[model samples]
Target: MTETTAPAVGHQHDGPHGYASDKGAYLKRMRRIEGQVRGIARMIDEDVYCIDILTQVSAVTKALQAVSIGLVEDHLGHCVVDAARASEAEGAAKVKEAADAIGRLVRS
Candidate 1:
């Protein structure tokens, strides 16, 4: 893998919404995670060893968490920031609400 960094928000890397933008990297990550999930399902059907299946299950969990964190970052960098800049009254509240939701997800 190339040494990498996420380009600054709303720069050339930003897509239509200027926030929640995909540098295409995010989609690719999700696709890989999806494949991993399918593989896990197959392992179950094929009666794979419990330890091996659990290892892959762990990988799937981490991949999903990574995806969620990426979206949260994009939301903050683009959507939340834009709303704040435009002086939307509920902007911060929305971000807080989202953060709380994610917190619950993480705790689960």
Candidate 2:
């Protein structure tokens, strides 16, 4: 799998992001996921059964996927729509970027 990195310094978005309105909720969900991950580590450390560990892993994966899908929808609704209103070229660019992101998600 490809490894993604943070945006380059000083290259951050100029305006509020697509998920800006729901940022708090997103962070909450992420924290929950983090806890789940820590739980998984504890399970391994405690010699939990293989199946049970796998089950927890699957749950964590699904939670992450849900977050991803929500972000995608937000991007399409807010960023893509706003770009479309700004200009055809900008809209097309954002669409392509979003498509690439979706492709990565699907492959994952």
Best model per TM-score: 2
Error of 1 at 60 (Å): 0.3
List clashing residue pairs in candidate 2.
none
Q: What's the alpha carbon RMSD for model 1?
A: 9.2
lDDT of 1 at 29: 91
List the candidates' TM-scores in order.
Answer: 0.73, 0.88
Candidate 2, which ten residues in sequence have the lowest lDDT sum?
Answer: 3-12
TM-score of candidate 1 versus the correct structure, residues matched by position: 0.73
Cα error, residue 17 of model 1, in Å, equals: 4.3
**What digit string (tens of lDDT, one per residue) describes model 1 on residues 1-108?**
442553433332233443235768887898899899999999999999999999999999988888778777777777667667756654766567667868987896
Can you write out model 2's per-residue Cα lDDT over 15-98, one digit (the tens) per residue?
Answer: 677899999999999999999999999999999999999999999999999999999999899878987897897788888889
